[model samples]
Target: MTSMRTLPQSSPTDETPLVALRNLRVGMPAPDGGAPVIVLDGVDLTIAKGEIVGLVGESGSGKSMMALSMIGLVPPPVRVLSGSIKLEGRELIGLPERQWRSTRGGTVGMVFQDPMTGLNPVRSVGALLTESVRRHQRVDNRRALEIAEKALLAVGVPAARERLSAYPHQLSGGLRQRVMIALALVNDPKVIIADEPTTALDATIQAQILDLLRDRLHAAGGLMITHDLGVAADICDRIAVIYHGRIVEEGPTADVLRRPRHPYTAGLLAAVPHFGSRGSRLEPIPGQPPGPTRERAACSFQPRCKHARQACALAPALVASGPERRVACHNPIEEAAR
Candidate 1:
């Protein structure tokens, strides 16, 4: 299998990435007007035009926050303290709401975790999808409906035209998810952010959804935010592991999954089930992650890391661990162990 590097050097002719995130820091203001509660800290990532990069992390590790920030929908109270989110060379961090409205579905699209909640229960699927198309493109009602139907067909939804007339409640879970994908793709966006798109589906349906995404995402960059390393391994070219709102490790998918450098990543891999390790018990990470109220200037995983030492009192910068890999750890898992 070939490995795809996420760094700039990997580009064919140093082409600019479709989406670039650098030194991103997002936080919520404290009630006392003191320090802010950080959600995403000094994160750097890039997505090119062709591959899908997976952001893997625990529930509160700020996966969704990163996604929302890119689309300029971080919501009130939680704000981007400092960061750069560039889509196709244009800065998106401080863009006005008016511009963001066009960019959200036109340039970058998002497929949320729950399709049921994502879609309007009262509105027909056609109404929801056509509205997105009409808003982004200067198209009439007939053209918008045609575009909506095409989007559904692109995502493998059967009876695409007829399905559009059905309400969200009328469709099955898989159908609803397919419709959600259609809505995201209807505007022909350059980048797509799929937040656990298969979490609620059965094994068969999940496989089908993944296949559809794989087929359609070849021409567009994708950021797949998932907690399951298994799912990331299946579709992502590279995997970035986030811990405590910071990216602890990032590398080609095969390399990270087979020989994780960060201890937290290793712990996560151990907890997942494998066919060969069927008889063995899974080892969960030892300590609970710090809540939003707790602020840590040092390494957030130190409390649970067995390799932690006095040097870990300060958070390590994400630096090169090996070829095509970076890890934020003073004591990374030795290569010889692999």
Candidate 2:
């Protein structure tokens, strides 16, 4: 079994990864008597302390599943079958639900993709924020309310005191998202998992929310799951490109964006528009992601890769190619000689 191994004793620095997922595999039982359905396959990722790690991929690429697994929020029909999720020297995977519940919001907070689904429509924003504060801190309603309002203000919501009394629907999409962020940060978690936090807002609003999150959460690290490479480039220190539930490449955001090493990663970057690009005609990756039910052996992306060779028939493990980059491909992209 692939195991999560830490580098022999290293001090905490801007360089050391704060959270690490090693050889992670999340799978579920197949409905028609077949091999287990693999949603996340032998994935490995690292996020430095106080750094932003962006996980990017097309739809159904298991970006959200990976995020949910980190915080023990994987819904039914999916389970973490193996691997270790280490956060600040503690293993999170395989921990009992009770233990995870105790540590989740306090140690690791999460801001889901859709604020509407995450927030309680029946309750006012104030009630929801207060509840989050009360759950983690030993404080009365008065103190919790104070903390809740402070959280709102921290996320840039004006008149936080008044906004707390309003229902989720009363706020704009951007405001509701800010409230979501406030709830995530109420307990001052060490790591925050934001899954497409800006999906529902306008481009300008999205930029604002991303900026706020990047600024306010600079002290604590973050893992942002997004399909937009532009967003990732704007906010993340490093980028991990996931294709068909597996990470094909990972490196500094600038490195990966400028010189993608995996075919899948290259295809994704090519599909994005550039400043000098001709028209708005976007070039999407051809073919759909493999079905979750399919049993995968060889490289899952071999069928779609333009550079697939005989060696690709055997799955490639993520291998270190440089001090800060890794690629899982038999035919890796050649780095330009300086």
Candidate 3:
């Protein structure tokens, strides 16, 4: 087994990782009389102050689930059975809904994947933004409106003053996303959870949105949930590759992309288009992700792993092997393999 890297732990007073989760397990009731489904199992993650951590994996890999769990937003049927979610060292797991309501959008903001779902179609962008500011701060309508306009302009929305009156349906997709970001940042949250913020947008617009988010949140530090390895490499200071509810490989973005230790991580990187690539076909990881109904007693990737062995039956924990790298594979890919 290769040794993993050990990075410096942020100081307790840093106020970074305004939000964090450790050993989180989200479960759902089973249809029949059996154990509840485990959507997330033993997940440990951290987002430091002024740092961006990308959670990358295929769909249903529990990336979004992890984000939702942090803010107490897991949808119906799925419940957080056990875990420790802390925001600035304050526990958030068992907090009541009222407390969560007070904390969410106030201290910790979130940006969803779809603007239409996140924004209110009936409400004008200005009203939504102003409401968010008013909800958290003890400000009157005039001050809230001023803060809203400033936030909209801060997000690069042109003529923010006039655009504030426009409803979400009247704006372009890119503009709507900008509004979503404006709303998320209006309260000056210490942390932001952006789940697939670039989904469904064209490459050009996607790049623009990503750039805006990266630049705007550069100092606040947050967690970005995404499936695009390219985006992860571009924006995240570090990347963690999740597979079947557990992180398989995690390290500095440059290190992970250049030398993926886990097979799944390698496959994801290989799938990204490279400049001047010659006849290199994108390789997809064969086999479907394990369904919620499936039992997870052993390694989740064993069935699709090329190096699986009898030892895979015993699940491997994420172990450090470098200054800033960790992998859970019994047989990790070496740097020379790629």
Candidate 4:
């Protein structure tokens, strides 16, 4: 993985984040009717205005669950047990469905992973985009259609108006992705949560979509959920590493990628196939992640971490490892060691 681009600078105004999650704990009912299964445990994260933060981890690491919780879409049975989610100083935890609906696309928008499945197959592009606009903004049908066309144009879709009549199946994969982005941006929401937005596209298309997002997200803060650290390094100003529902490490992109403190973060960075290191074998992290039902009495990563110590038997709090960086590890890799 070659360096994609110079990392974007963190905002000075980040003192007040656009989205703040503090001690967030989400859980689902246990299979045996015992205790609930924890999906997100005491997660703390913040995304300031005009910055894109990456929420990254392996599958079932609660990345998507966090995103859903923000948009008030966390499915039933899986509940937000305790936590505070503030959007620009407004509380969103117990908002009613009506308020959540208004907040969904008005204040926060989401770009799901699969454009094919995310878009409504029966609806035309015009109808889909216009409906979103009308639902959020007080706009007539004609104005909504105009907004939809303008959004398409903004996303670099050719013949924006003509494309409005086309169905989701009529467009190419790249075009569908563009439409997905356009829909997310149509309302000009303050916070955008893009969950693996480029996963379904090819490399070239993925790069294009990423570029589009970077350009369009300048006004609003973003949370990009992905497993691809390369993509995160390319576009995110900061990166947060979550494991078994806990944020184990977080820092600026360059800092985290160059000199990771947590062993899991280091393992993830090492697993990427670097362009400069040709013929070198990838070093995948050893062992599977703990089951969701497993309790978090001790360090959840102690089983797979080579640097684990007896102290790891007790869970380490996410303490400051460096300026603007936090790592939850009893024996973090020293900066001089790398």
The lDDT leader among the candidates is 4
lDDT of each: 0.89, 0.86, 0.86, 0.90
* Residue 109 CA displacement from its true place in model 1, Å: 0.8
Tens digit of lDDT per residue, candidate 4, span 1-338?
13311323242234456888989999897779887889999999998899899999999999999999999899988999899998876779999999999998888989999998989999999999999999998989999999999999999999999999999999999999999999998999999999999999999999999999887776688999999998999899999999999999999999999999999999998899999888999999999988686477889999999999999999999999879999999999997877
Worst 10 contiguous positions by lDDT, candidate 3:
1-10
lDDT of 3 at 17: 56
- Against the true structure, candidate 2 reaches a TM-score of 0.92
Q: How much is the lDDT of residue 169 in candidate 4? A: 98
TM-score for each predicted model, relative to the true structure: 0.94, 0.92, 0.93, 0.94
Q: lDDT rank, highest first?
A: 4, 1, 2, 3
lDDT of 1 at 13: 46
User: Per-residue alpha-carbon lDDT of model 3 for 1-338, expressed as tens digits?
Assistant: 12211323333455435566788888897779588888888888887887899999889999999988877899988889797887876788899899998788887888889986778879998899988898899999999999999999999999999998999998888999999998889998888889999996778989999998897667687889999988998899999999888889999999999988898888788778888997989887788888764488899998888888899998899999688999998889876665
Clashing pairs in 1: none
- List where candidate 4 sits over 4 angstroms from the true fold: 1-15, 30-34
Model 1 C-alpha lDDT per residue in residues 215-310, reported as the tens digit of each score: 666569899999988889999999899999999999999999999999999999998988887789999999898766436679999999988999
Please list the Cα RMSD from the true structure of every candidate, rounded to 1 decimal place: 4.5, 3.1, 4.2, 6.6
Could you tell which candidate, 1 or 3, scores higher by lDDT?
Answer: 1
Error of 2 at 1 (Å): 15
CA lDDT for candidate 2: 0.86
Please rank every candidate by TM-score, starting with the best.
1, 4, 3, 2
